[model samples]
Target: METGIRDIVLKWTAVVVAATWIIGCGGSATKPSPPPPAFPKAPAKKPSVTSPKKATQRPYKVGRNWYQPIPHAHGFTQKGIASWYGKKFHGRKTSNGEIYNMYAVTAAHKTLPMDTWVRVKNLDNNRSIDVRINDRGPFVRGRIIDLSYSAAKRIDMVGAGTARVEIFALGAAASGEPSSKRPPAFVPVDYNKGNFTFQVGAFKERKNAERLRQALDRRYKNAHISEYDSPDGLFFRVRVGRITDLAQAEAYEQILIEDGFNQAFIVAE
Candidate 1:
């Protein structure tokens, strides 16, 4: 009976030892440790922001027509009908590739170099305002400048659809120069030297251009034909006179206009 008791005790002790070994080894015995508490992921970084780029001024196209802007605003002055545009072109892209702002003190000129600062005086009321040229326009035959709504209002020309005005170029606002509020003294364009010509006409046919040029050469002396390869095709332009000074060119242009060359306009060669 005592030997049977000893064997039963030994079997119990063996069972206890096996269970202790399994627990110490960290086997599937201890509720499988809660999969190492998950760590929260770090927040993602945001992209950096940068400022918009400034636009550049260059030759541009409008309504299937190409316009070559002058190089500078040296001594530019003119007297003609001035008009204003507002909501219709407020957000459109200007000739200089800038967004149009109707309320800004800006203006459009057919050929004045972009970024030129011009002072406009309303002859009717003597009201004046300084505006920067940022686009091209006033496309109308007698219109010489197109002002922004705010610019027109400053000159008291908003009530009138158009106003007779005198414009004087102040050139690009440079350091040590007078500010727009106080424009520098008006300097008349009296260039003693420059290659200036008058573009009288452009023709698709070289023969027609040559004939006109030959006729002009008899009286104008320096009349010639220039060929241009436009996007539409090739064109021959008839130009007359090679003069020095814009003043002389302007006077000559008037004479040509009276002589039936109504389409003549001054151009820097």
Candidate 2:
């Protein structure tokens, strides 16, 4: 009886071992899962600057000079005397970081891209030439088109400090691409900080500016005094602030003018 029982037990153990081996072989056949797919990245783009866009470039009346606002469009046209600057400022960095060479066909415009190409026509002489804008200002009011000395020579404007002429953008840049603003229009930083301000009196007198600040505070609220050194190295600016509202600011400027702050202006902070 004992011998028969032992044989049965041995057979049952062997069967159990065989079943576990078969299950292990089946698990090996099932492989591991694959990874998920990745998404693609996009291309980068440049920044855009937003300034006032006029339907027609308006004539800017600065002092006695008639400033014509160049419309911020793909092309432009206008009439003015084209002149040039050379020698004294040659090899100097223009307003847009370009070296000034009177020998090159460059122009200075109060408003235009630094590297824009425009076809200038001397209406008096019936002569026309192309130029690139690399600098700013004829600063003498009542003038239009500041040409490089070479460009002026080419268009026969060397003799006359002023002339009658017309300018039209030709949409050609040195890079072999359609014309764009010479120095690509980059955004400027916000030039404002809220604080007590002082009114600038005649720039010549420091004491006068301080006196005005004290007087402004007596008439108004929270008026403090401070002097701002200008980049031009002339004139210390006085300001009256610690106030809000555009209308209030304009009214203050009028008051200062009335009180004989002749050069008094508002500093928007």
Candidate 3:
């Protein structure tokens, strides 16, 4: 009886150990589904880029005064005292980037656009000169334009330093009109023996002066060569279009400048 009891206990013990072993092997084979396949991390995002802004055209102030550059200077005119500059500023870069030549027929204005053509009339003596606006200046109160040395000399204002002047804007066409509208044709007037004339060129050689006179004669009603005896030496001067009226001479002076005779200046006979 004892032996049978012992055999029954051993059989039950063997069955419990086999069942535990089977459960352990099944848990090891499953492996927790390989940690759910480890989903790939999302990619990092990048930044965006942009462009720069443009400059604005706005009115600005300078010193104790305010200045607004006229959007369009066409037909703009002003009258005030005119002064001049010379050797001190020569060969320096102008406000418009041009090398300032005090001898050139150019001027500076507080507000006129660069390259503007202006006829400046000296109210004191009724003398006039044509100048191209290429710089900005005369910041002093009551001053309007700053004339180049040669331009001021033409109007007989060099000795006076400053003079009351009338500035007329030219080549500024009326809005909607062609910029190239033909200027009025020059009228031929009776040559006054004592009238003032424009000297387009002066040459030591008479033949050279004659060649310029011939060129001017074709375009002008009257062109002549005159002998000038100066302290420097004798020179042949080519003069064109005699006029007694200073205003008329100014008009002709502008025409001569536009025709590329930039050195042309008024000479009183």
Best candidate, lDDT: 1
lDDT of 3 at 239: 66
Cα lDDT tens digits, model 2, 124-233, are 88888777766667664345678877678777877665678988875434343333244333233222222223234334466765665566556555445444444334
Predicted structure 2, TM vs. truth: 0.41
Q: Please, what is the whole-model Cα lDDT of each candidate in the order they appear?
A: 0.64, 0.50, 0.59
lDDT of 2 at 38: 24
- Residue-level lDDT tens digits of model 1 in 1-269: 11121111121111111101011123365585655322222225312212212323333445544455654567778999998887667667776666676767889897887667888999999989989877778766678899987899899887666899999987664545432223454444444457876566677899988887776665556678888776677888776666677666666656544554444556677
Judge candidate 3 at residue 250 and give its lDDT. Answer: 52
Q: What TM-score does model 3 achieve against the real structure?
A: 0.42
lDDT of 3 by residue, 19-125 (tens): 01011112345455544322223225311111111211122234433333433344456788888887667667676656676766888876665555678999999
Candidate 1, residue 167: how far the Cα is off, in Å: 1.4
Worst 10 residues of 1 by lDDT: 14-23
What TM-score, over all chains together, does every model reach?
0.63, 0.41, 0.42
Ranking by TM-score: 1, 3, 2
